[model samples]
Target: MAYVINDDCIACGSCLDECPTEAIAEGDIYTIDADACTDCGTCADVCPTDAIHPA
Candidate 1:
């Protein structure tokens, strides 16, 4: 399964650079493109708010 960004996201932009596939998109809450996500968990590790998780 792909990783998902939840409402807990603080829009910190921390996950963007950490995403190897560049699946993350900028927004008020930010979002992850499921099609591009590889479930690497890299983005989730860098999320300061612990917002990203398994889908």
Candidate 2:
């Protein structure tokens, strides 16, 4: 499963650099491309707000 970024995301762009597959996209809360996500959990681990979770 892919990781989903919740509304708690601060749009800090921290997760962007952590995504190896370039699955994350910048936005008001940021978004993860489920097709590209590897489920590596790197984004979640680096998220300061812990907004990323498995979907």
What TM-score goes with each of the models?
A: 0.96, 0.97
Off-target runs (Cα >4 Å) in candidate 2 are none
Report lDDT per candidate: 0.92, 0.94
lDDT at position 8, candidate 2: 99
- lDDT string for model 1 (1-55, tens) is 9999999999989998999899999999999899999999999888888899999
Number of the top-ranking candidate, with lDDT as the measure:
2
TM-score of 2: 0.97
- lDDT per residue (tens digit) for residues 1-55 in model 2: 9999999999998888889999999989899999999999999999999999999
Q: Model 2: number of clashes?
A: 0
